[model samples]
Target: MEDFALEHINDSRRTILITAQLADSWNDRIKEIAPDFTIELRPWAKAADIPDELWENVEILFTLGAFPTPEQAPNLRWVQLYSAGANQAFTGPLAKSNAIITTASGVHAVNIAEYVLTTMLTWFHRYHQFGSWKQEGHWPDEHGRDLFMPEELRGKTLNVVGYGSIGREVARLAKSFGMRIIAMEQRPDHRDRGFLFPDIGDPEGKLPDHYYTKDQFQQALAESDVVVAAVPLTPDTRGMFDATAFHAMKESALFINIARGDVCKEPDLIKALKEKEIAGAALDVFADEPLPDSSPFFGLPNVIMSPHISGMTPHYNDRVAMIFTENLRRYLKGEPLYNTVNKERGY
Candidate 1:
């Protein structure tokens, strides 16, 4: 076998296989990074039409929107996922394959953190309801009396459920606004590390006073003024936030879910909001994409909903492309990749 050298691999005119649609800018960026490499764009045709010849010669397989079964690409060595979440692709044959899988993780962190803050501010300031009030010509006495019902984020405790890239960014931004941050993760080793808030200059090394395991999540919820769910949707996380968990939150506490929709039980959340178990919620992702017209969340005054776009921004594609390109360089160099998911732990 030939020794795989980073420079040599990139210089060999190797064919790079892209498995789904690539934005024009992203495609151009990839070419800029690996000018010597041949780019092969393979849009999602039927599974039967995936060319075996292309797979045989390709050195890297870039998966955008869909994943190929391991059997479909026997010669594949590396699989770079375009999205942050790899749940849809990490299964069956691909799970067992020798291919090195990497995801676009940290790329969306800043954008998502901004989204969380925007939603939180909107709810706290009552912007949504105010818009409705303006449209209905129903000005309340408070509106004319120069009174505003605004909630303060300062001095509030924000509990982040998963301290991954996105969670880290959210914590940093929250800290900037004078909010105390708490984080919980499954791994006990990361409890005091405070890697999540390091970006905000460490803030005098003030680590979360309360670090809880999955078993202690209820206790975390009880003290949290705001609970932000950034956990991925794994077998353990799916439908994890049900009635019981919601009921554990303080009656005045707010909930924010920027994680997968399935991680929360929609019906249970509705019940919690209706019964005043929680003050309010801001949901970016939902169990169903483009939530059905009949979904109760649309009609709920206490909930703020977005179409699963907390991580979206105008520059998102460019950032994703840059991360993927850098990781490709790392892969060729045999260097450690950032944000590598634990397949067994499922992120």
Candidate 2:
């Protein structure tokens, strides 16, 4: 088949295949941008639900789950991912395909950033202890000062391991609290362009006190009062936060992971927290989904575990639609797509 994107350069009619259910108004919203395009909406609960014929004609694929191979989608040209992380999508035939992949990287930044703040504030303000007191109907006269004193975020150092959309948003919010920020990214010199929501994060790159590359990651960890893992899962980043990285952190520093769970070895993190190598950790993602019921994280007092809900928000679908709309406009104009994943980097 001729390159579908190139073939559609002057054509207004195209085919968009989406897995997730969309409201009638949202469908209209998409049609408003590309009125001539035909859309096929399916539940996409299973990968095999999409028939070979459906894959053969789809020019654009919009989905959260179910990654179809290039062999299956012969006419596929672009993939608009509903998820921020593209680790799962970049596997098997999809990794080597000629189709362009764009992520909703900035879409979830707001909610994830808020989750990070909530996790940190919950620890610093001793909300967990207060909740326990409320449950027991016991009011402490000293406000649990002896047991837990409130710590302010002001003047504290925040080291963001990945300076992407989520990390930048975290830094933006942290800066408002008077916290100092440092960040590590694969390329500090490269600035992210083509974002529709510039107010959502540090688009100007002024939030971080310093920027460090991978070589200086350990140095970034050692100086932080709070360490946040917001990088993608790649060959170089898988198990990046091992025992050595954890041990390099300040004994009193708290760790927050809003990125992929596999970024840090679960056993290594458990050992670090158990040994008090790091003060505590709040994890939103895990190495395994529905993190096994027998997992020790459920019972750990110093650990705050959530079921991968950091990126969740009431407006998620709407935000995603906006990203898709912008990318669609670019696609019609034959412009470079936003959040284009570098296959070699695996982001």
Give candidate 2's whole-model lDDT: 0.83
Task: Give the best candidate by TM-score.
Answer: 2
Q: What is the lDDT of residue 218 in candidate 2?
A: 85
- Cα lDDT of model 1 by residue, 1-347, tens digit: 11233333433647788865668877887787777778988766444566666555666777664445666665567777778887844665567776667777766777888888898788777786788778979777854634347888888999989877777778878887888888886555553221122253222324555567888989889999999999888998999899999999999988999999999998999999999999999998898898999999988988888888778777666666776777776665676665555677786
Residue runs of model 2 more than 4 Å from their true location after superposition: 1-13, 140-144
Q: How much does candidate 2 score in TM-score?
A: 0.92
- Tell me the lDDT of model 1 at 232: 80
Candidate 2 C-alpha lDDT tens digits along 1-347:
01224556343445788886666788887788777778888855555888887777788888887677878887788888888778755676667678888888888888899999999999887887887778879777785556667999999999998888888889989999999999986664636553558587887677789888888888888999999999889888999999999989999999999888899999999998999999999999999998999998988888987999888898888888888888888787777788887777677
Minimal lDDT window, size 10, model 1: 192-201
Best by lDDT: 2
Q: Candidate 1: deviation at residue 322, Å?
A: 1.9
Cα misplacement distance, residue 88 of candidate 1 (Å): 2.4
Q: What lDDT would each prediction earn against the true structure?
A: 0.75, 0.83
